[model samples]
Target chain A: MNSKTAIKFSVLLLLFVLSCALSLLFGGSETMHLSDITSQDFIFWQIRFPKTITAIIAGSALAAAGLILQIIFRNPLAGPYVLGISSGASLMVALSILAGNSFHVFSDFFIGKSFIVVSAISGSFLVTLLILLISKKVNSNVILLLIGLMFSQICGAIQTALEYFSDPNSLKSFVIWGMGSLANTTNKDLLLFVPLAVLCLASLLFFIKPINALLLGQNYAQNIGINFKQSRFYLILISSVLTGLTTAFCGPIAFVGIAVPILSRMIFKTSKQQIHLLSTVLLGSTILLFADALCNSLLLQVSLPINMITTFIGAPLVIYLMFKNKHW
Target chain B: MKGEAMISIKNARLGYKKSGAEISVLKNIGLDFYAGDVIGIVGLNGVGKSTLLKTLCGLLPPLDGEVRIEGELMTQIALSELAKKVAIVLTEKIGGFNLTTFDVVAAGQMPYTNSFNRLEKKHKEIIKAAIEVCGLKEHQFKLINELSDGLFQKTIIAKALAQQTPILLLDEPSAFLDYASKHDLFLLLKKLAIKENKCVLVSSHDLDLLLKYCSKLLVIEEKLAHLISVDEAKTDAAFLRIGGGFI
Candidate 1:
């Protein structure tokens, strides 16, 4: 790393630490104090701690997934949310939550949670597989992005139809879930979410050689001894897993996946996957944690949904980037 | 001077498959390529010039027959192994965000890098040597998106050089280059063939340049390909038909 990159990395690391600290302290309806010993422990351990950690995981996971999608698809606008992978998860989750009353099996708390996780993962995985198939026949970037948009529209229409028929109580719960949140994750959910996200994100490091080769385009990647098909499969698989699990635990958070990777690229000014990966993770975590903190600020009478805050911040960042770098 | 052919092709039908049908462009090709040979491929546009190069580089499977490299079947050789023997410079323009000229050239060393792709001292030296050879030392750190067309083409050529392969294949490499750079590129290919004993194949419409620098010519005409000596090419009927007005 050069002196400029080192300085930038150090600043990002510091920002991440600060964001984590602020998130833990002020991430609940009532801000908890570190000074008080007895009354604060319950709020800190149960509510604020899980919410803060969930933000970090979801942020970094989506960021890494977005970076991979951009590289593989060679499109700057690609992300789990935009590509319909998150909506695939949402579609399954809608089925489970809205129509789940008929199953009765989902009434059992532990089984229902696990089922939701499975449905989300399988939903996103199936969509990712479909996208991969279509990408083979359609090589143009604009066409692939349009296909992704079409997938989202189809999935959204189905979800709306499902919502129209479901019981009012179930529909209400599903609506809240769709808006996105980090507060729902308890310590138990972290056992699965943390390991899966960490594993998938870390494994991305192993494919650094192939991912870097892809920047030259697929044929060049193949010529340099990188297995283009295998690499693309594993990359999309990992990307979908990150998107699925995050959507499972914390609704479909927007903008972090799309905006953060671009931000990292802008900050670092290098396409070397190693630096981009690290910077994306750090910036992603920081942004989400800060957004979560903003969502829970005492100034608001009712706490806003996490998605609303992220979109408010993420959407503008994306628009700015699009205009700032026309080619990006 | 001929001893053993470095590459041999027998009855290879080169083309692509579409909707479960084979569309053959060049049929029943037989040829032998030796080290220290700089052969230029001449054909009209869309006459399977790129397809032939793609097939030679193992990007496409031939419809029938076989291609052999150093006595081993092309299909039998693994991509990783083939990567060590062949390098290519194609015509397509690539855009990689924040990718510098140095980074693109460093990719040529990927076949030799470790799992994490860490560039060792020796690898860095090779990358640097390639950049210098391609005259990109000053623009090494510039982003590829910022470089002009000629500089970007040079960067890719430098990448192929870093691969350090014995067989080099280029498809319309001079399409974006200026006149001076195009001459320099052909001269470099000639030097690599004669001095380093590399087998080089270049496809271009620059027949005059090819006649001046190439030892032999691979002419594709009417779904047939013929590999002939440059002197023979000057008198060949098909070559004259294609280059009749110019030559």
Candidate 2:
């Protein structure tokens, strides 16, 4: 890396460290003094640390997935949610949560968590399979995007209809999950979430060359010896897994995926995947950790939904990117 | 000058396969391209110039017959193996996410790089050399979206140069270039062919420029491709007919 790129990376790294520290120190309603380390140990280790880790994993995964989608689809507006992956997960979760006692698998803690995760992943994969099949027939990226939107709309309609017929007791839990929370994950959940997120993110390194070639268009990428179909399959698969896992755990957090990638491009001012990947991941984690900290520190009595904070920040950044003259 | 043919096309039929049906555009083409040869492909719009280039570069398969590269059948060669042998520059505009001239040019070394796309010292030298040859040293770090049409065309040419392939194919490469850049482009192609013993094929509508720079001309008409030397092209009936208004 050149000195300019190194400086940019240093700045981002510094912000990431700051965000992590801020989150660990001020992440819960119960404020504790550092001097009384033993007295505050339980809250710090049990609650604050896990929430921070969850924010880091979910944020980085979503942002990187968004970046991959934007490059693969060659669309500026493509995001983790654009392909209806999140909606598919939401629809499945709604069936389990809102369908009342018919699916009583949610009664046990371990079974409930695993079942929710499996349901979300299966739902997203089913939708991804349908989209991949359609992609082979369509020639234009615009057409694929329209088809994805149509799928998302269809999934949303069904989810809404399910919600309409559910009981109020189950509806309350479903609505809370939709609001999104980073605090629900404990140490046990980290065993699965951490490894899967890391694997999906690391798999991207193998595709750095193909993805770079693809930026010039499919013809150029193919001319450079990339198997366009195979690469697309792997890229889409990685993105869906990342999106599915995050949505399953955190409940479809919004805007961080789309907004962070565009922000990284504007800051770094280059499209080299190596640099963009690092910056996007770091910036993603930093943004979420800071947002989560704000949710905890500002409203001590009532913790705000993580999605509300992210959309509030991410929406305006996206708007600003749209108006800017530089192409991304 | 012709010890062995670099590329030999044997009765190749070029066209698109739409929904499992072959739509042939040009047929019965037989030709031999040797090293140090600068050939220009000329035809009317939508007359299969691009299709022919695509076929030679392994982007599209011929409807029938075979294209042999270095004595091996084209269909038998893997795409990865073909990448080291041939490079192409098409007419399409590439819009990417803040891709700089340097980044795009660096991608040319991808076929040779490791899986991580690392650029060693030698790879960096090759990329720098290509940039200098294409007169894009001043704009090497500039974003592609910030470049003019002419410079953008030059950047793509530089990328093809960086690939360092034995055969280079370009389709309508001069379409977006200015007059001087177009002249420089042909001059560069000719230099690369003769000095480096590379086979170069370019397709364009610039008949005057082609006649001035190309060693030979391949003219397409009525689903037929006719190969003629530059001197013979001056008096060829098909060439005269196609260039009637201007030549």
Candidate 3:
């Protein structure tokens, strides 16, 4: 790495840490004074600490996922949320819950939430497989993008229709899940989220060579002896896994999945995935932590949904990028 | 250097593989490429000039007969070995990448690199020579997407050069380039063929200019590839009948 990149990385790391600190110390209540160990210290350690880590993990996973999708699809605007892969997970989880209720399974079940999470992940994997199959048949990125949007619409409609007939308590919880939150993940869930994100990110890093060659498109990549189908398959699998875990724990926290990678590209002034991937992790976490901090601070204790915060920031950027460059 | 065939096609049929059936694009192609030969294939749009080259490069397998490289069937050679034998420059634009010209050129070494794709000193030297040969020293660090069509064409050619293969194929390499850049590109190809002892096959719609530099002409007429002397190609009965102007 050059000196400039190293310096930029260091600055981004510092900002990430600062954002995490803010999210931990000051959220939903008075900022805990580190010097004074009061009852509030428990809130800091137990609640805000896990929430901060949750924000960082979810944000970084989405960021890397976005970068991978963009590279494999050869579209700068691709991401887990935008491609409807997360909605697929959400659909599966919702379906599992409704099925359990109809069978009276939830009444006797204590550990069924884990079953929902497992089903959600498999739903994500199935959708990913379907998308890859279609992508292989169609060479156009725009066509695949339209197909993903259609998948989102179909999946979202099914979920909403299922919600219409569900019980009041189930409906309310499902609605809350759709809004997305970083505060909901318990320390127990952290054991699941952290390792999965690390493994997927390792897969992302390992794919640097194929992804770099893919910049010239699949024909060129294939001609150069990189097995194109295998490369794309592994990348899609890793991207979906990351998206699935985040959707399972934190819900579909939109925008960060699509926007942070672009923001990193803008900041670094380069489009190399190796640099963009690394920068996406640091900058994605920094932005999400800051957004969570804003949620805690801006509205004065009544925190906005993390999804709402990201969409508010991200939607306009997507519009601006589409306008500024017809390349997308 | 101009002795033996680098690649030879024997009655190969070119076509598109569709669901449950194949669409025949072109048929009955027989040709041999040798070092120090600049063979230019010319045809009208939609006449499958690109298809013939794609078939030759093994991007699409021949529907019939065999394509042999150094007496071994092309189907028998692994993709890695075939890549080392032939390299092609495509005209398609790969935009939205933040890659520099140097980085794009460096990707040419992928087939030879280690799993991690680290450029050894030898690889780096070859990549440097390719950039220099394409006269891209001033724009090596420029982002590829920011370059003009002519420069982008050069950058893609430079990438093909870095592959260090014995046979190079380019499909309409000068299509988007200006006249001056077009001449420069062909001049570079001619030099590569004669001096570097590489076999180069280029397909172009610019028949007059192509005929000027090409040692032999392959004319696509009525879905058939015709290898004729540059002198005879100008007035061949089929060439006159097809009557593609600007020849």
Tens-digit lDDT track of model 1 for A245-277? 899888888888989989988888887888899
| Cα lDDT of model 3 by residue, B151-199, tens digit | 8988988988999988899999998888887888889899999998888
RMSD of each: 1.8, 2.7, 3.0
Tens-place lDDT digits, model 3, residues A1-328: 6788889999999998899778877765567666644565767767887898989988999899888888877878888887788889999988988887777665543356566667677877788778877887998777887888898899999999999989899999899999998988877778777887888887777877888888889778877777777888788778877888888888888888788877777778664578888899988888889989888888785888888888988899988987876543
Worst 10 contiguous positions by lDDT, candidate 3 chain A: A105-114
Candidate 1, B1-247: lDDT as tens digits: 6877878899899999988899999899999999999999998889889998899888988999999988899999988888989999888888757888999999999999998889999999999999999999999999888899999999999999999999999998888889998999999999999999999999989998999999999999999999899999868988888896679
Question: Residue pairs in steric clash, candidate 2?
Answer: none
Q: Which docking category, incorrect, acceptable, medium or high, applies to candidate 1? A: medium
Q: Give the alpha-carbon lDDT of every model.
A: 0.89, 0.86, 0.83
- Name the better of 2 and 3 by DockQ: 2
TM-score, one value per model: 0.96, 0.92, 0.91
| CA displacement after TM-score superposition, residue A109 of candidate 2 (Å) | 6.1
DockQ score of each predicted structure, in the order shown: 0.74, 0.73, 0.45
For candidate 3, state the interface root-mean-square deviation in angstroms to 1 decimal. 2.3
Model 2: residues >4 Å from true position, as ranges? A35-42, A96-115, A125-151
